[model samples]
Target: MMLSFFDQFMSPTLMGIPLIALAIALPWVLYPTPTTRWLNNRVLTLQSWFINRFTQQLLLPINQGGHKWATIFVSLMIFLLTINILGLLPHTFTPTTQLSLNMGLAVPLWLATVIIGMRNQPTHALGHLLPEGTPTPLIPVLIIIETISLFIRPLALGVRLTANLTAGHLLIQLIATAAFVLAPMMPTVAILTTSILFLLTLLEVAVAMIQAYVFVLLLSLYLQENV
Candidate 1:
């Protein structure tokens, strides 16, 4: 019974091939491609506008050097955003809910930012370990703590994304199961549970979008510090 709740998170397979690859690739196919026409359909127009706005806002704080990351940032944001929202659909699997996948996305990107900092400005990057005017006694302790915190960034990014989506998915399933079990025995209670489920579904949708944005925003902040 306990495992049933988590079964949705497992990667489904057909002919011994994991379907997660298809799930990850589906978002790209869903979006319409741009054409040479001056006037695009409403879908393409909206896509362009949203991408433009997101790119501008994301790069606003970044230095010109960091601005070079604009394409990667926008693409990641769209990929995450689409997958998260699509995962909310019935019978669909969410790739971002997996810690391994989230870490796969977070670690390299986080490392890239750190690498940029170290390569471009070694002094400034290393300086983050210990602040100015530190007492002689606390210097060692502070450096160790800061270094630990620096390494934990990728872990935090992965765990944060995984935990939020997992919790929301679990809650939705629990409420749904309850609503189904109680429908005949306690119609009133089941109705209330269903209503709550509807509200929670909406909140989860918002969370999906927000988490994607937050993930990218943090990367941008990391880049800002480095660049």
Candidate 2:
């Protein structure tokens, strides 16, 4: 009974947005949980040869409080990625295609970098924006320009991800729509369109991972600039 309601509400793109939201929020809920599922905590041997240690640095140390912030960034990316791919399924929606959703992800990451970096050493972390070696006369001008660019990371990341996903989805939708109209007279058109759609799906998979990686990597780099 409950499952049916879940299925009903999940139709069209609107349904997928909430699911993506859930995925995005999951890390927060799971952060305090120390009791791990068997799979997360242990490794089985192929021939009863060895038991490899599982719980190491890869777990993201949400419990430590020190690394909890990194966990959140990684979790957000994973959530966006899961949602982006979900839209590819028939009858599902693409959350990342929406600018608001992508901005929601990017803005927070940008804010986190600023907050964390500044908290480390407000003045020192900020110094990273200016050139390492610069004339005193030009320093003021350079700092102002670089500060503006720093402010733009959220905008840039948001636009790039949103545009790519939105455009890709629209292209695939148009091609698939065209297939129906052209199928009777030119079946090959549908075939070719489908082929293109398949290729784009593969491209989307790469984009999903790459975009997330880029976001996380850049955030880390920003942190490294200060720490």
Candidate 3:
């Protein structure tokens, strides 16, 4: 008997060692490395094409200085894309579903952008705390509000990724269980539920891809402001 649906979100373990570490590292191993040859393999060619296109589209709006982050952001986007999709497979654990793992990724990168802004343009960074043409009565309140929002950016990033993935997974599991139980009692209802599950799976696939893009895109936006 299942006690809680949330239990599936818990990090799986083997021999008292958390398997989330292995899941995190698995994406790198799965990627095909490029070989030095006159003609590259299809996998290597396709990988290069995708990365080039993604980097070009992602960094087009940012300044020259922000272009330096192209490699970091591109790599992160691929890593996230891989992990998010892999979690959809049967019996697989998704590290991104854990708020701790998401925050670990979010906080450092977000902090780096903030630090860059402060170090490179202190006046401009502080200037964001208060908008131009503000009334004297609201200046203090606005500053406090902006400061809180600034700090909340990382939290929002982590929570957004976690919530989207977690909700999709929970719904999938819930519907699957219902279909299983209904199959024995009412085959027609079970078939309809199964059909719905198939459509939901397709939607979840799109969500997985989109959430990965949104995560990296927001990080790039943060870097844009600082650089």
Each prediction's total of clashing residue pairs, residues at least 3 apart in sequence or on different chains, is: 0, 0, 0
Give TM per candidate.
0.98, 0.69, 0.98
Each model's lDDT comes to: 0.95, 0.62, 0.94
- Supply the global lDDT for candidate 1: 0.95
Error of 1 at 141 (Å): 0.7
Per-residue alpha-carbon lDDT of model 1 for 111-133, expressed as tens digits?
99999999999999999999999
C-alpha RMSD (angstroms) for model 2: 7.8
What's model 2's TM-score? 0.69
Better of 2 and 3 by TM-score: 3
lDDT of 3: 0.94
Which candidate wins on lDDT? Answer: 1
**Model 2 pairs whose backbones collide:** none
> All predictions: root-mean-square deviation over Cα?
1.1, 7.8, 0.9
In candidate 3, which residue ranges exceed 4 Å CA deviation? none
Model 3 alpha-carbon miss at residue 6, Å: 1.6
**Which wins on lDDT, candidate 1 or candidate 2?**
1
What does the lDDT come to for candidate 2?
0.62
